[model samples]
Target: MAKRENIGLSRELRQTENRAEEEAWQTLRLLRKEGWPVRRQHQIGPYIVDFAITKARLVIEVDGGIHREQEVAARDVEREGVLRADGWNVLRVSAQFARHGDHLIEMVRAEIKRCCPLTLHPSPQGERGT
Candidate 1:
């Protein structure tokens, strides 16, 4: 269950978030249908990630125009470093990717696979099972 404050904050963010954010959210919903188990505006540690797959320890960030600014870019770099040090895989995507199409899901899936490869189980016959 989410805390009341975080729930309220997320609601407020949803209402005020830019079009890119809203669109990215829709894409994330589609990814969920594909079994990614991602959450929007999820809080992790001291910051809020645009989307997170806790079980996978993946954090997704959607960068808008403001992200291009020097200060924001620097902050983002620092934040990502912290997350990485904490053993979280951070994937950053441009909001423009959302405007174009649903390719974001594929990209995220690939990143997940790269960051956390699935361990194969052994078959009864001593073969590897995918």
Candidate 2:
């Protein structure tokens, strides 16, 4: 059936993305297992977030600083604009974060603490209330 075929195609597409996502997920999971809740490769408007914590409405990107050249940076800035326009916080982690031990973990932890307060529970003072 056409529906079955479509499902198969969808599965294939997801698999392709999953492989790339896994590399990033492995690093994030290390922090998550320590108590920071994270979602792997979530979808935003016209983009797939490398990691997202919806509870904090934060998007975390594990970039290798591979976006070289002005054009690439411009595109990234534009993408960020789109994301920001939608009321989301963005965090870009570089090779230093995950490649080294403990440092990246701490950074992720701090970000979660910061963003979490903004998401699940908002306070009247324009910050999330505990």
User: Tens digits of per-residue lDDT for model 1 on 25-89?
Assistant: 77777654555566778777677788887656888888988899999999999999999999999
TM-score per candidate: 0.79, 0.64
Candidate topping lDDT: 1
Candidate 2 lDDT tens digits, 1-130: 3555555554554466533345556666665444445666556666766677665677877665565568877887898889988988888766455455456556766776776654443332322331
In model 2, the clashing pairs are none
* lDDT on C-alpha atoms for all candidate structures: 0.75, 0.63
RMSD of each: 6.9, 7.4
Model 1 error, position 66 (Å): 0.9
Lowest-scoring 10 consecutive residues by lDDT in candidate 2? 121-130
Local error of candidate 1 at residue 37 (angstroms)? 1.3
Angstrom error at residue 121, model 1: 12
Runs in model 2 with CA error above 4 Å?
Answer: 1-24, 31-36, 118-130
